[model samples]
Target: MEILKKSQSGSFESSDIIILIEPVEPNSGRNIDIDSSVMLEYGDTIKALITSKLDSYNISDIHLIAKDKGALELTINARLETAIKRACNIQKATMH
Candidate 1:
């Protein structure tokens, strides 16, 4: 999905991450900027995870910033997914 405007999700709580996203020109490509409290070792892993998720959603040509506050992989994934969906105006599915 193409991101239409700036959008964000998550909180600054102890074990959460905040994701900010904005649409960019298609030719500009995807740019991911990550600031993590545990960048010493897990930086690449975190970046890879984010990239994979974006790819899974077929999202390119966007600027994404993830601010991590010692969150786990699951938390990061959820936040990023929420932010992307919001930016793309994709509604969450409801269960019967």
Candidate 2:
């Protein structure tokens, strides 16, 4: 999983799960639904989903910084996956 250059820090560790969250408006994308806007209070739900998705991997440390663009749960998930893949340096996953 340490395929990419160790970001400014050192080797990636799975024990570390860094999460940064920011608030955003709604209607940022076509895939995003306004009803899912309940993410404000349900942010932990998104975190849990992403964590679950990354749980099976060999990633020891994960640093997830999210910029909410008024998107829904699905959009958030897509963006998070993109970020994680980018962090791990998966060349093919960067097609986004």
Candidate 3:
């Protein structure tokens, strides 16, 4: 399931994260840009978490822009999933 359009979730509020998702051309691969207060400590981990979620959905052609406000792993997972679902016009939580 590839992202169909630009979609976003979360906010810039403290302890939260804002995620923006957009579709990319087929075979262009996935691109994720992350900006976070904890980048120095958790950059690679965040990217891996995001990549794992995307892989779970079999999504490869997309671009993600994420600005984190010191959010936890669970929060990041939730916001990212929400943004992806929104981009794909999905209503339920049947993530797959």
Candidate 4:
């Protein structure tokens, strides 16, 4: 999915992360910028997770900024997924 504009999700609260996605020129490839409290240890892991999620949705050619406030892997994944879905205008299914 092509990201048409800037989209964001999550918050700066403790144990949370904020994700920002912006559209970039096609063929430029995906660029991810991360600011994490635990960058010294988990930076690569976080980037990998984000990359995997984006790839799952076939998203590329965009710029992603992730601000992490000491969140766990699961939290990061959830927030990133939400932000991607929002950017792609994909509606989440509701269970009855």
Error of 3 at 94 (Å): 13
What lDDT score goes with residue 69 in model 1? 83
TM-score of each: 0.91, 0.49, 0.92, 0.91
For residues 1-96, write the lDDT of model 4, one tens digit per residue. Answer: 888778788899999999999889999999999999999999999989998998898997889999998899999998998888777777478321
Relative to the true structure, candidate 2 reaches a TM of 0.49
Per-residue alpha-carbon lDDT of model 2 for 1-96, expressed as tens digits? 432432222112332223232222232211212122344776677556666655644444444353333455565555555555655666482343
What lDDT tens digits, residue by residue, belong to model 3 across residues 1-96? 968889989999999999999888899999899999999999898899899999998898999999998999999999988998889888486543
For model 2, what is the error of residue 84's alpha carbon versus the real structure, in angstroms, after optimal superposition? 1.5
Which prediction has the highest TM-score against the true structure? 3
**By the TM-score metric, which is better: model 1 or model 2?**
1
Q: Which pairs of residues have clashing backbones in candidate 2?
A: 13-60, 13-61, 14-60, 14-61, 15-60, 25-70
lDDT of 4 at 7: 79
How many backbone clashes are present in model 4? 0
**CA lDDT for candidate 4:** 0.88
Q: Where is the poorest 10-residue window by lDDT in model 1?
A: 87-96
Where does model 4 exceed 4 Å of error?
93-96
User: Per-residue lDDT tens digits of candidate 1, residues 28-78?
Assistant: 889999998888888898999899999999987899998898899999898
Between candidates 1 and 3, the one scoring higher on lDDT is: 3
Model 2 ranges with Cα > 4 A deviation: 3-40, 93-96
